[model samples]
Target: MAERPVTDRGEVGGASAAHASRGDAARRLWARPAIAVAAIYIAARLVTTVFVAVGAAISNSRTGGAETIGSLLMRWDGQWYWVVGVEGYPSELPLDAAGNVTQNAWAFLPVYPAITRAVSFLFAGQYPIAAIAVAVVAGYGASLALYHLLRERIDRSAALWAVAFFAAGPLAALFQMGYAESLFLLWLHLALLVLVRRRFGWLYLLIPLMGYTRPGILAFALLLALYGICRWFRRRVDPLPAVQIVHIVLLGLLAAAVGFSWPLIAGVVTGDPSAYMETELSWRRGWTGDHGGFVPFEGFIQASAIWFRVWGMPEAWGYVALGILVVALIALLVFEPHVRRLGVEIRLWSAIYLIYLLLVFFPQSSIFRLLMPLSPLYGALALPRSRAWRIGVLAVGLLGQWWWIDQMLVQGTTFWQIP
Candidate 1:
């Protein structure tokens, strides 16, 4: 080769040094947790936006190009949220011809819609714009919270991987939709982090936010109750102080109060003692006929039988399957090494939340969205050191994201296709 121009060092050495400098800079940039989390969240949101665009295009094509992306994003529960924001919940609950309570804005909580309505002033009073903005922004915060929460238990690399999975997993489209899930998740992750760090004081604020953002605060209260019991049992080892015990008790009570406060408010507004419960049960009526009253765990059992019969299986098989599932989950939390790696607080929250869901939620297409709270378990999936395993999980999650968007957003033309 002709003589390469080099001042002091050889050409190869200079080029190598330049490459090394660039590599070091890249490492330094990635070392910052916020930057890495933002990068992951931004990239994932872009992918989800593409998926949403594809769904919107497909939906419009099917509907003679009449639907816009905003309308598509504002479908299903989004419409309900908008109604809650603009019109407000009715003083009188809507009733059907049969004199049963019907679905109304009371079924949806106030926080997300209230926030969206306020933000809409910035977007020319367009609730859709404001809703998506809130969801997207809260989703980014949730991602950061989740990364830090995982970091409390796992290594930095694994925590980042967990966030990657969470941001790109199935139902990721909710982050860009008009739903309250993203905001609720933000509060939930922060609440869990504070709980893990023994910062019970933060929960006084978080509990109300979570209670109004979604219906899962009761489960969190239950978690706190169990957490206190566990602390008491392990006090010899962990030394649960008197102050900490008082926090646990007061927070548990505060969370429970807030959790039940919405129902009480709905009852007061509508002049129907069972207004909120009846409104929620109105949704389950579509599948199970008419339920006379709200009963814990009854919805799941009835839904299991109904779904199993629809699927051409014996109804008893559904009960058996439910039993098996409960056992399997208990085993996973108690025995699985990967899950144990996520630490006790996460595992306890998962168990409590699952129990709460089983108690009140009817099994439906929306169950997937409801299960988003258990996302901390994703850390377990990211724990294995095998590169192939991590990549496989990530690939599967993206594929699921596309499938969920298509099924629930694009081709969701029927009642059961609710997201």
Candidate 2:
């Protein structure tokens, strides 16, 4: 046999060695704590899907509807979002016999729908599946953001626990569904991460779109304002750099505009500046009256009143529980050392959003779902030194998610459980 050329053999051996080294490096990267956390998160979601699907199957058995795994993931508000994705928002809000803007597509924000529509175009106009896919993808991004954000403040193991806890939270089922929560969370966590990392300049881009994604732009803007003021004070900027101040002011204005974009469009189309408010309040018009003013503890009062009447409990008990719950929330925000231990970003987000929730939200069975955005905060509670404690928290979260799916999604139609 002809002797192989020495140069050719050497080159071939060197190439094989380099390929093996690269493969080894890749394996090392895959074994990193962050990657492991992501794997756990994904595994938890797969388990959550199974639980929700089984619950839906049982629900179909009892209720006798053609509910499938896919349909089960796209119930209630999912359907509304799909409508906006397939058929753009109605130019004229649907009006009731009394001329009040009845509940319509306007109640659902447009960003998620707009995204779904864009994706649907790629999929030959199959929107429902597209909508679910968007939610699922956004949710995973949100989880990674949360993990990365937590890692900035806590040890890797604890941060992993926090992400896992979030994935197993009571409303985790919604993360994989066709709803806006996942997308909203992706932006919200990302914004917090940027804030924690002291990248204020990026807010010019993030805040505006964040505003468009949900109705809580003012809360985030206020947080930014507070941060900017603190930064100025820390630096003792006696005259305040004109450029820095102007940038902060512009960020606020941009946030306001983007956050209120849909409402502004609605107002212009309907020739009613308050059209968005009117549409939002239409759902509560029956009992909430004309004005959409914030009332402290009003949601709890509304919920307590409902429970008192429906469950035949003493009205006093509802008030007592409400008081306890409110106090607990306040303590968590104001006094809990664990809260202070959180990154300033998460701490501020929790305190501000909880205030917004208590003031504006009318509590009901659906209140749990509404509070889903705050799931990131609970990750702190999941940070226990004891392995058993960590496992216990995760178990409770998993069970809560299953129960939510069972009661709210499956048995909800006949019962009073809200989706």
Candidate 3:
């Protein structure tokens, strides 16, 4: 007898138990509830294009830009991609221009244009609506991802409902826009889901692409990378019970990196990173808080009305809308305390996401559509437990979402033009 195997039952049992858990996890899909099949069940959420039209009406009614009459959705950054992809950027500036946007061509260089170009080529420009169409696809694709990711811990039924919430939020309107918010969210969530699984090598490669995708994603990518590395090292001693401290420190640095990246990069290229900062601060377009410091808590409070309310007043409502959205998010998170594995799973991931959204509020529009990716976490927290209530609330939220987008996408008198 080969030296009577000396395997300790505790260690052997631990390995055996781990395998058993994975096997159980695999079966979760078959045993999953009906709600988890959210993507298939709630195909009505695909009316995103219809809602996009609604948002255009609301946005246009408030804005009076040149494109407002024909198709109001084609304002600000929207015009950039259309004109650039449809008609490339101008290489030369008019005589008195001194390098200001003498023409409407320059906004296309970011990731949005590249996606648009590919789409237009594939469609043969038979429809200049390439960007918006891509957005529609991205929105649904992200929704599908959310369902699969959440179905693991929550009942399948609730997971499906969460998909409903995501598809039906103002986030859908943001997704419909010619902007890159939808694409960015899709990328961020997929990357994060990967992170949750402890796959670091892939996480590093994805961060830079994310960085290039939107302005601050690079910082987000970097911060996540740092955390994953530290966690890996700490794994030698077992998951750090005190690791939360290190996380907080990393988060602070992440905020700093994101805040400074725009100006810092510009400064290096233009021999003055503050060039970007000057554009934002010299003008009164963004947050009124101290330009050099972080966005204060009070600033967020002031912007509370942006998410749900009309926030008709520009300065006051801007801050007020964001504040309200923040509150709503926190409330939802708290209500679903059971979802964090019923308190077993700490709320750190969602918290980090919430904080990231708050920090970026100073620059983005007051509503903070950036929190869209964080919704799956909230949805995960609320599922299968309530079942009926969960689906009902999500239905209302999703319907209201379309209405919101519809209302936003209107004619000149309805939308606001930033000074």
Count of clashes, each model:
0, 1, 52
**Against the hidden reference, what TM-scores do the models get?**
0.96, 0.85, 0.63
The best-first sequence of candidates by TM-score reads: 1, 2, 3
- Top of the candidates by TM-score: 1
User: Which candidate has the highest lDDT of all?
Assistant: 1
Per-residue lDDT of candidate 2, residues 1-419 (tens digit): 35668778889999999999999998787668657756877898899879977987797788787787788788888888888778877777788776777778877777888998899887788888888888878888888888888878777778778888887778888877888888988888888888777666888777766776667887777776776676677666444567777776777677666766777888887787777877776765555555454346664566568768888888888788767987888787767776667865677778777777766666666778878778667667866689999889889988898889888887777424667
lDDT of 3: 0.53
**lDDT, candidate 1, at 122:** 99
**Residues 216-305, model 3: lDDT tens digits:** 553464455456566667666756445554553555455455545645555564564334544433322233333443344433443443
- 10 residues in a row with least lDDT, candidate 3: 410-419
Q: Write the residue-wise lDDT of candidate 1 on 109-174 in tens digits.
A: 999999999999999999999999999999999999999999998999899999999999998889
Q: Between which residue pairs do clashes occur in model 2?
A: 211-259
